[model samples]
Target: MKIVTLDAGTLPVELIKPDYCESWVYRASTTEHELLSVLDNAEVVITNKVPLRRAVLEKLPSLRFICIAATGYDCVDIDYCRERGIAISNVPGYSTRSVSEGVIASLFALRRNFNEYVRAARTEWSDSDHFCLHKSPLKDVQDATLGIIGRGEIGGAVARLAKGLGMRVLFGERPGQSVTREGYTAFNETLRSCDVLTLHCPLTPETREIINRRTLSQMKPGAMIINTARGPLINEEDLADALISGRIGGAALDVLCKEPPAKNNKLISLPHSNLIITPHIAWASETGVNNLIKGINYNLAGYFGGKVKNSVI
Candidate 1:
């Protein structure tokens, strides 16, 4: 079978070669026009973030199976693929630990005043009136309330880690829910109560811009937000405003509404010492990457063996 992998650069390392394929081709990055040529006659396609919606998939006459290299398969057009009989699979729960660990690390850095102290040590500490410069507050992670949105694999992992540090955890119910379950708090109530809030939800119409001006206004004055989930969960302009106006204390975002944000993206141009933005590397740990590779191979093997593992359709 002919196989083509588009945007292999999304993964930090090379994927294991599938021995069963008769032909294999890999592209470091594939653009819209470029994908047309690369996928023209492929029986199988492996993509990390290069979308394969109906517009792109319809032209590929030979395409049969699609193996998404990540847990989130939002890029694919599920309804069209289902109607067209294109098999789809994804790697899920592969990055649970890495993403959860990243959230925990960011929480400590933001709450414990690590960013402020690091900058202050270079200049302010040298000219301090006392032995140590203490302009920024250093707070302990323990005994704080941590509110988690979408308590799936990664969120559950975060809850376990936070509880170990003595944090009181609250799982949030859907936004605007009139009644909450026994374990879940009303979304707005969770926002008002949390010392730290982290997102692990999928991106959908109901969840897009879940954190905006109205929601930010409801949060505690100095609450922190850590987003290792999909972007668009929080509105960038609203978040920038919240950070600048001191409505929220801090934020660490691994993903953005736009990847490799434009030069003039609101968050990129905004100046805020409390806001930390990493280039979506929360799930790029070596172990996580390996798990993804294994997941893909397992799916590929299952498809050929009449089982089809980790399918979305």
Candidate 2:
């Protein structure tokens, strides 16, 4: 078997190789322009972030399998893979605990006013007449309603954890979906009712920028937004504007529309004290990373042995 990993650096740790395999791993990222040449002779290709769309896949006839190194397979063209008889697999639920905990952490950080007080505690406390400086309002998670979009494993896990914290959880139904389905609140109702709105939905034409100016206007003026989901789910410019205008209280994003965003991404340049942006690491707990690696190997082995796991198409 021949295996070629377009971007091995994505794993950031030692990885296991399949037994008796011809393998090549690239430390640097391979662009769409460079993908076909690098994957020319490979029977199996492994990728984390580099996209393999219809145009790229059409040229690679040797590609019998695609092993996605991460949970999301949006980077690949699912229909093209199916048409080409290429087996595709992703490592799902591997980062469920890691991401759910990260979302909870972001929730507390914003709601408890930790971001404001952390910077204030350095200077304001020294000049304070009292024991503690009142930099901002501190809200308790116990009474706050957490509205979650996307009811996947991560969302369900977050709901369970938030309920344990005494939070009122509302799972948002699909947008424009009128009939309230079982175990779901209407879409606009979730937007209108939440104290903290978090997105766990995938990115698609319908879902991209679901949080635009109009939707943000529907949310509570003080509601905080946390996106550990796909980035483009929120309109970056509109999110910055909402923070500036006090339409929303705060936001912490683990992903952006563009990774290592252009020097001019609206959210990246904002000076809002309530906004926090972490490199896309919500799903990158050390344990989660190892589990993903194991899952990738398992999927690869399974496909060759007569069954494939975690197929999106």
Candidate 3:
């Protein structure tokens, strides 16, 4: 069996070559122009973010299985794969602990004004007459209401961690549904009540741009937004406007609409200390990376052995 891994550089950990493989090739990254030639005659392929749409997949007659290196498989065209009998597998829940921890850390950082104070320590602390140079008000995390959008593994993990810190966690209902599920708070109510709102939902047609001008208006003034989920979950331009007008307190985003976002991205140029944007590293903890590697190997071996694990097809 011929195996190829596209964008292997995205996974920092070492991947063990399967003993049952004849040809195993690894590429640091694959460009759109090079996709056809690179994947030609490959029986199996592992990809992180390189897209495998229907148009691209139609040309690859030799492609049999796709091992998505991450939990979110939005990079691939699922319907086409299903139609063509191509197997797809993704590693899920591997980053539950790492990503949930990142949310808690961001919550504390934003609510407590860590960034502003850190800047003060460097620039204004020495010159102040008082021992403590007070600037932004620091809010306590305990007894604060936390609204979680998705109740998936990572969202549940975040809720557990928040409750342990004495926070009130509300699981938001589906956006358009009027009937509130037994364990869920109404979507609008969650937005109106939460002190901090974090998104863990998948990006679908219903959820794309869920946090826009209308939803932002419902949030409590000075409420913080944290997104470790897909970037399109929030409208970037609207968020930038809200932050500028002080309608919302702050936002910490691990993923953006564009990864390695354009130099001229609106949020990238915001001069607010409250907004925190990271390069999608919320799921890159050492332990998470190791678990991902194990999951990938398990899926690969399982498929060829006739029992598929983590099968998406």
Candidate 4:
């Protein structure tokens, strides 16, 4: 069998090829223009983020199976793949622990003013009159109310961690969902009451740019926001404006609308010590990466053994 891995560079570690494979091609990345040409003769393809829409899939008659290297399979056209008899699989739950921990870490950093104090230590501490410097107000995590937007594995994990730290966790129902579930708080109510709001939902048409100006206005003044989920869930321009206007307390984002964001990205150059932006590494802990690679290998093995595992289609 012939196998091609598009965008192999996204994964820090190399993928182990199945022994039955006849040919394996690992390209760093496949641009839109080069996608069709590169995947012309492959029987199976592995992709992390390179999109495989109908236009590209229709031309590749040889393609049989696709193993998405990550949990979210939004990069592929699922309906078309099912129609074309193309099998689709994805690795899920591998990064649940890693991402949940990262969210809590970010929460502590933002709430306690870690960055501002670090800056003060180097620049302003020397001129201080007292033994300690009070550059920014520090809040205790114990009594804070945390609002989580998703009820998936990672979201549940975050809730458990927060509760252990003496926090009150509220799971928010879907936005505009008139009927709230038994254990969930109304979406709007969660917005108004939460001390810290964290997003763990998927990116869908209904959720894209969900945190716009109007929604941000509904949030409690000086409340913080954390996103370890999809980037586009929060509107970047709106977030930047809120931070600049001092309406929102702070924000820590592990994902952006555009990965490896451009120079002119609204939040890139903001001079706020309260805002923290990471290069989408919340799911990249050492254990998380190993679990992800193992999941991929398991899926590949299942495919060769005549029963595909983690099959999404």
How much lDDT does candidate 3 score? 0.93
Model 2 lDDT per residue over 1-313, tens place: 6787877777768566777565755445677778877888788888999899998889888889998998888999999888888999999999999999999999999998787888898867898998878877889999799999999999999999999999999999989988457999999999999999999998889999999999999998899999998988988888899999998999999999899799888888887878889989888898889889889888988887889888767
lDDT of 2 at 231: 88
Residue 36 miss distance in model 4 (angstroms):
0.9
For each candidate, what is the lDDT? 0.90, 0.89, 0.93, 0.93
Q: Please give, for residues 1-313, the per-residue lDDT of candidate 1 as tens digits.
A: 8888998999888887778878889888888778888887898899988888788888888888999999999989999889988899999999998998999999999998777888889968878888988866887899999999998899999999999999999999999786447789999889999999999999999999999999999999989999999889999889999999999999999999989799898887777777788999999888888898899899888887887789998
lDDT of 4 by residue, 1-313 (tens): 8899999899989988789889999898888889888888898999999999999999999999999999999999999999999999999999999999999999999999998999999999999999899977998899899999999999999999999999999999888897547889989999999999999999999999989999999999999999999999999999999999989999999999998899989898999989999999999999899999999899888888899899997
The C-alpha RMSD in Å for every predicted model, in order, reads: 1.2, 1.2, 0.9, 0.8
Stretches off by above 4 angstroms in model 1 are none
Error of 1 at 11 (Å): 0.7
Candidate 3: the clashing residue pairs are none
lDDT of residue 262 for candidate 2? 95
Show pairs that collide, candidate 4: none
| Residue 119 displacement (Å), model 2 | 0.5
- Cα displacement (angstroms), candidate 3, residue 70, comes to 0.6
Residue pairs that clash (backbone atoms under 3 angstroms), model 2: none
Which scores higher on lDDT, 1 or 4?
Answer: 4
Candidate 1 has which clashing residue pairs, if any? none
Query: How close is every model to the real structure, measured as TM-score?
Result: 0.97, 0.97, 0.98, 0.98
Clashes per model (N, Cα, C within 3 A): 0, 0, 0, 0
